[model samples]
Target: MLQMAGIAVAGSCLSPTYASKSRLLVSIPAQLHREFTPPLPAFISLNQRRREVLPSKSLQTALIRCFDTNKAASAESEENAKPNKVYFARDAIVDAAARIAPAVANLYARKGGQEEEGEMGSGTVIHEDGYILTCSHLFFNKMDVTYAADEEIIVCTQDKEIGHVVDAYVDLDIAIIKIDSPSSPLSTAKVGSSSKLRPGDWAVAMGSPLSLQHTVTLGIISCVHRKSYELRREGMAMEFLQTDCAINPGNSGGPLCNVDGELVGVNVETMKAHKASGVSFAVPVDLISAIIKPFQSCQMPVQPYFGWVMRNVRKENLEALKQYYPTFPNALEGVFVQKVIKGSPADRAGIQAGDVVVDFDLQQIRNIKEMMDVMVKRSGTPVDVIVERLMLGKNRLVHLTITFEEKDVAAPRPRL
Candidate 1:
């Protein structure tokens, strides 16, 4: 063995307990001849004169192995040190916001002969002829009053266009304001299918949260068809698109867009932020047609009656369902019909309360909202409903065409 500069050149490997972990010189090679040169310390010369010596074949072989190992390690370190590239949809956000921002109208209301302009909510232009969609709560304080000709209603557009209410839902928190004779052409956002939304899809929320004009925030769709009662404890029985996007007081009635610069939902409410964080909900874009369709014929905006109260089958509810219906299938997915109204479409069609709805009108039913979306437009139309019912202690599939009833009911209100 040879020793120099506190290094041990031994024939055998040293224990890791006593080895210097910071440096690998002692671990790399076993032998060092007079020609051996350290990377550092300049290999201090004896008497200030350098001596020439030839290295043995074994020493050269060991040096070669050490060089190969170091080369491989350096390559690995370089790979690890390389920075990663992060991709963002900056152009998508900018374009989508441009299309949606023009339709957004900041609202201010004067109630009960008050002269001051009170902050209301946000609105989106659904029609090119100046039809703006907004929340119904924006027009009323304590008593719900119709926007009369004598009352003062202000709708300030992104391009400084003034508008007023043309149509409003009596029950639901949805209304339409119209911009009369605008200075320029209105920019209407393209409406996308909310039925296509999936969990973790990119979601962009543009609204005046806290009255901050045209504020935009980006997030993912945390969930789809989230029930209103789950978040608010007690409120309207409605489905919403739950997201992590921040929604504040004045963000109501604003647009919730997708990555394709299309409107997917309407920003309605923020979750209990005092208890939860990054939780908010939006009304699905399908509801916009639900609020507008009935009024097209100069009739009252009545909710399309499905005559069945159902809940999405989740893991937590599976156990409860098993206790009630012992023969319920363990692999069943979709909606669990909780109640069937007597003499209604579901009840007359032989759909029981415990039956699990798997498909509606040939389309697979994944959630409660999917079924609602189908029934909302087909109020009087007969559609096939496929359900799984337990009969004779076995699961059986039942198919029936049920015609929905059209009844005068208030539109669904936003709960949370």
Candidate 2:
């Protein structure tokens, strides 16, 4: 027997002996309609019956089992219901931005007791003792004298504080400023590993864009290994983490964070012509960490110098080169040495112009970027380089070992 919404059902094929027993009182909720009701058994019949019905004990037990199953199913469906993906992503971005907001600071370059509008920039506090990291170019004047003789760097945290330029690496365009926050420890951002990053990962940029403090922008990692030379920034041997996050002039030196609010890169420059195209670049935190580690001991990091101009091997460029040297190698991939500085490491190693670099430090060199990446890591060490050259009207592989000379940007000074 089954009952639902004032309707009673009973099995018609029940034995006469069981039907002669006392009627079973089965009751169901009056509000339950066909939509909420479960399917009835095939042997049951729905008809206008009294409030009580006669049914076998086995049939009564089956009806109770069906109701229990439906109840459990409805509960599971409600439990599985979840919010949209957009809401989850929104919360992630909000939490990430809030985590790093306290460590970001606005920087101002003041000259003649007035703050220069164009000299505004951003920085991230990397130490609890008020050590801020920012771009060195922010303090450069037309004459490029670090900071002008009369200009001062004013760091604005929760309150205004005078900042002193403790160290500056012009080659990498990184600067370290110190502020005296002895009364309280400043908030510092947690650094993350940029080498583990991949394309399409979430990126968050926090800084003061257009002098608006605490600005945050959400974007994805456009690329992980964008070479500096590819962006027309010559002589820089580092690669950047390219992102679509909006980084304006004032956003430079700010922290570029991941979805978990860890600092992965330092916001650097954006394509001026493509400002609306969402093309921006950040210096990978790995390189920044290497450069700043020596600063803690009041020492400057070593800058590796490789005096050679090179480019990737393209068909058009190779054809142009073959016009001059008809015996140039017709290789599909290799770094083409265009010019070697006189008396430099390449020149000293017998590497001449028109040479195609095949391998360096036991690693194949496919482009100038790869060569630069390897050279930066193996600084102040001797490495074997293999190049293909036309010798006596025949292609010959020449092996040479070159040692890189590391130079310091400035002398170490006592900490401020």
Candidate 3:
């Protein structure tokens, strides 16, 4: 089941920048309703975004002066006076869209010998050897039988091709599909650095939203990290790149490109309704870099699922905590547990908010990324964690044993 990104309410709200009533609706795939029993709608809010300020008055006046014409001027002289700002970026976007469109696949799934009519979601070609990356949820069905070796799944790009699931990592909602012996080498996407993305950077989302093939939407990055509020209910401590890119149902698993047409993220979630311009989320490209080699090689890497999100302890946050609790840990190097999912491995082990994870299985965890690496390296094994718990105006050292589960959507257990 899909969950909302943030708090959502049913009503219409006027957007200051967009001269339209922006309504909020869920972007859950329509195939879920047609192919199987329909689930309840995921409520997500599309909050009004910050507006971009116009250029300075001096610059505008100068442009106006350049374009201003005398009564004696001819048409040829008027054309020469127009501003000639070199904009190669527009051509780059168009070229990139054309180059990448053939690699984006429209997925189709079957259950009990019945084929779904429409596309499930979009996918990206990560390798010229026919390796595709998509969301894991797209492979799931409400059928009793597993997919057969042949004719169970098909991928539609420039031509329809049989696709087989190579590997999947449910924690990041990433799935790898291989086209069964393609005719020729496919066009691969140019991956960009998500670590370098800023809040106001230009973003372009390309996908088959609502089955509209090759649709592209433009927006700016609203936030680098938008944590899911319904993490406990969803069983995944999810983080996403929040943007007002107008993503719809079929947009999931498509490429979220930067201004230079490089893939910065994989489009995953969105907020949309009857009359809403939605906010979309993407899995950062940096996260993919860690395991792309294994994924391309058709190997399932161990993605640790602890059911909690953490962040590096900044000096400002440490100062605030110290002021509130006088005995807060003086040691500044550790990851702070921000949220722990209910009934998860971390929750069962008694992890809580305001707890600083000092050590993981005897290894010091300096940041959240380091913690993730530790989890991946020690998959399916019980590990001891040393956390400094704050209670009664003092910091107490606590040791907890937690076994992380490998992220698998096919398993009956909880997945990330």
Instruction: State, as a TM-score between 0 and 1, how close model 1 is to the true structure.
Output: 0.50
Each model's Cα RMSD:
15.4, 13.2, 24.1
| Model 1 lDDT tens row, 9-73 | 33223555444554446544443543375533222223323332212321322232222222323
For 54-126, candidate 3 gives per-residue lDDT tens digits of 2233134223324332233445654555565543454766776666676678777755567777767888887
Q: Where does model 2 exceed 4 Å of error?
A: 1-89, 141-150, 180-183, 274-276, 293-416
List candidate 3 stretches off by more than 4 Å. 1-89, 112-114, 141-151, 230-233, 272-276, 294-416
Better of 1 and 3 by TM-score: 3
Candidates' C-alpha lDDT: 0.62, 0.68, 0.64
Q: Write the per-residue lDDT of candidate 2 for residues 181-273, one digit (tens) a residue.
A: 334667878778899899999999998888998899999999999988888774436789999998887999899999999989989889885
Residue pair clashes in candidate 2: none
